[model samples]
Target: MKSRSVIHVTGAMNMGGTERMLMTLLRMKPPWKSIFLTYGTGTGTFDQEIKDLDGEIRTIPNPGSLSDHFQLFRTVKPAAVHAHTLFQSGIPLAAARAAGVPIRIAHAHTTADPSDKKGRFIYEKLMRASIALSATDYRACSSAAGNYLFAGKSFEVMPNLFDPKQFKRPPEAEVLRLKLKYGWTDKLVLGSVGRLTKVKNHAFMLDMLSELHKQGIKAVLLVVGDGDQLKTLRRKAEELSVAELVTFTGAVEDPSIYYHLMDVFLMPSLFEGLGIAALEAQASLTPVLGSEALQPEADLGGGLLYKLPLEAGSAIWAEKAISVATDSHKGTSDPVAVPPEEVLKHYYQLYRWKGGGHEQKTADYII
Candidate 1:
């Protein structure tokens, strides 16, 4: 008998929050075989790992035509097609509907797009209509994301979850060694993890570092993740005259160990669907100074999340970061982590669902 499979449509299996969440779901060993259809042509960071797990990765053309997607859907004949491409999800989902796939899911992963160009609004309106017409179910990582994409429509909010076991605190010796290696000894270490993009607002982190220095605080910023803005951010750090105080670690296969080296984790994003790094930081017992734009659900009830507005500027942010990091009791308790099985159950339920009417409660299908 042939194995049942699900097709996941995404941009690429890169190191981003959405991709990471998909990876977590894949690692949970869902009942169906997993196949990914990405828009980018070349290999991604997670390509090899997917192959190792007996999963397949195929590429569709950028701005893939509906016919292209329809053909692929027919060729694969997936049990379900789950699209994570936000507004553009409608394209593949419409194709899946045409291909007679029983289950089509449109997942929203971001609250808003910071790079909208002229006529983008009109495009989004059309795609959203298509999504409504074709998708059998809708999902989002946060309520904000759900509202942004599926307004006037009921959708399930599936919180992004990670395996806490992967983020165990490092041994004292290993922590000390990393601090020594990175010249982080006797300094307040501020860390941020995400692609170095304008939306992530890493330049704001440099400003915060500069402010800390003026306040006579010995501080260092550790930036993890690689992106197109790397050289620009490095230049900005130099222009701020805080070049020596910042360390850019580029991309890493695992950032769990780095959480142990941070005094406080920082996320000053302009906007976020849900900040997965904040959850990871809290899981590792590190306090977070996040942007007010982040979804409140990102907090794991660990009492470690401190929200600050971007309008508050760097000085206020610096003060809050220091206060949060130096508090002896803050971040001492373990965060509330959902069990892997619990998270997997929701995905399993969605995959097993046979769609009927939109009047059905989302709770009936998801936990």
Candidate 2:
């Protein structure tokens, strides 16, 4: 009996939220095999893990080229092509349609568009239409993403999966030693986890920290992740004169441990589909303050989560941050984490049902 293969299309399995979710799904140790298809090779930290799990990782050179997708589809002959990118998802999904893959899933992860120019907007609209037409099913990490990308199309909300056990561990002494070394013992330690990109609104975080300093509030921010905006954000932090108070840890393999060092987890993203980091923070029983644009679904029913408008000014956010940080008793019990095994069960069931009750679907699913 041959193993079933699923070609999961993604940007790169780097440190980004979407990529992290894909890694979690892969780590679920699903019954079927997986093929990770990215636009470029050797792009993510999970590449070695994918290989260790007997999964094949392929790169499609020139993602915009349909010929590249078609060749890979022919070679892999996947039963399904699940795309996780935004507007660009339609490209691979369309190739899947052309290749006759029976089960195509388009998973949305973000609510904000990177651009709004007229030409780009029209192109994205057409891309979304293609997604609706070519995809056999739709999935999103949150309702906001579903409404933004797959509106009017039936879709399922796939909760961001994480292993609760990983976060349940006590903080490492090394992490604590570093915190004490940095003199963060007495200061409120505000932390956030995400790429230092424009969409993440890291600049606003700096401004807020600057405002805190101006208000005579002693706080330090720990940013865990790196991106194209790292240099720009550092420059902006200097411009705001808060460079000394902000610590950028670049990329960390496991961010859950850092949550232990934070008094409050702040996500001031201009927009978010559903922040998995916020969920991770709550699972650690840490208080979270997010921009109003962040989806409320992240709040798993506890006083741990708070949201305020971006227009509310840095003073208001800093004030809320102080209160949340200083509270002796803030968050409720750790929010229940969606088990990776449970998520794997749902995905495998969908695969089996769609593949006609077979133990493993034949590659001929490409018809």
Candidate 3:
């Protein structure tokens, strides 16, 4: 019998949440021969995981050009094309539909920029465009993501579940502290793992840290991931007098070490479809504290969620964070019991066992 093939087209293999979630999904499903598409290159990228599973990896660029889509469609010839984020979803969807593939599903894992009425309109328009172009079905990490990504479109919920075994727990305090140059004594370790970009809202986290400092609290912030906003966020830390307390580790593929070192995980995102990093922190068994509900799904059985304003004005967000710090118990730190690998397995079983031919209206969903 011929084996079924699945292709996952994503931004890159730069170790972002969406990319990592794809990796975990590939790892959990040994039966599925997965293929990866990246816009950029990474050495030893998903090196072992993909190789060990005998999965294939490919690279291509969209450049917002027409030829890119044609090239992507012809290359893989997959039974299904699973685009990891909105930015790259339509390209593959158009390609797959043109190629007459059975399924072209898009997954929305990142929070979008929706500040003004016009901005929201554009967002809606983009959602509609993608829906009209190539997507067959829609999958969201949370219901919020579904509403945001495919308001008029239809979608299914397949929460981003994380596998705990992928994370290597740091030894109790001593080793990790010495490595990170942080003292293990009285400081509370508050960390967040994600790209230092506007969407992840590192700025908001910095403001929250500044707030913690003013309250005579000695908390340390460790961040894992890098992006365009890294420099600005670092400067903000200095301006807020929290520079000495913040450690930006750049981007590391495996965040379990960082997760192991943290006493508490922090997600100060302005908006989130679903916070996978929070799930990772939960897998690490460290508690999470955030200023807003990243997603109703992230708020599920674990983690603490607080209300936060979208101003990004620093002071307002800082003030909002204090209440969370004072009443820390209001946040759940033990992490949720759900396993991400299991969730992926369930999705595979539900979809593959049922055997659908195409996603249909799913493409026209969020656009």
Q: Each model's RMSD to truth, in Å?
A: 3.7, 3.1, 5.3
Per-model TM-score, in order, reads: 0.93, 0.91, 0.80
lDDT of 1 at 80: 86
Q: What's the lDDT for residue 254 in model 3? A: 73
Q: Please give the CA lDDT of all the candidate structures.
A: 0.85, 0.81, 0.67
Choose the strongest candidate by lDDT.
Answer: 1
Identify the leading candidate in terms of TM-score.
Answer: 1
Sorting all predicted structures by TM-score, with the top scorer first, yields: 1, 2, 3
Model 1 whole-model lDDT (C-alpha atoms): 0.85
Clashes of each: 0, 0, 15
Off by over 4 Å in 2: 1-3, 169-175, 353-367
Q: Can you write out model 1's per-residue Cα lDDT over 103-158, one digit (the tens) per residue?
A: 89999888997756999988889999999999998999889999999977999998
Give the lowest summed-lDDT range of ten residues in model 3.
358-367
Residue 279 in candidate 2 has what lDDT? 79
| Candidate 3 local lDDT, 1-367, one digit each (tens) | 3226777777566667777777777766645568876664554345566767788777664434446656665665566777775654665677678776666788877557444555666645764586667787788877777776676678788867668666546566654566456674567667788777776777777777787788787777888887778889888888988899998888776778777776667777767778878777666665666646566676545444554556556566555444454565654544454666457555554335332322234332211
How many backbone clashes can be found in candidate 1? 0
True lDDT of residue 22, candidate 3: 74
Q: Cα lDDT for residue 296, model 2?
A: 66
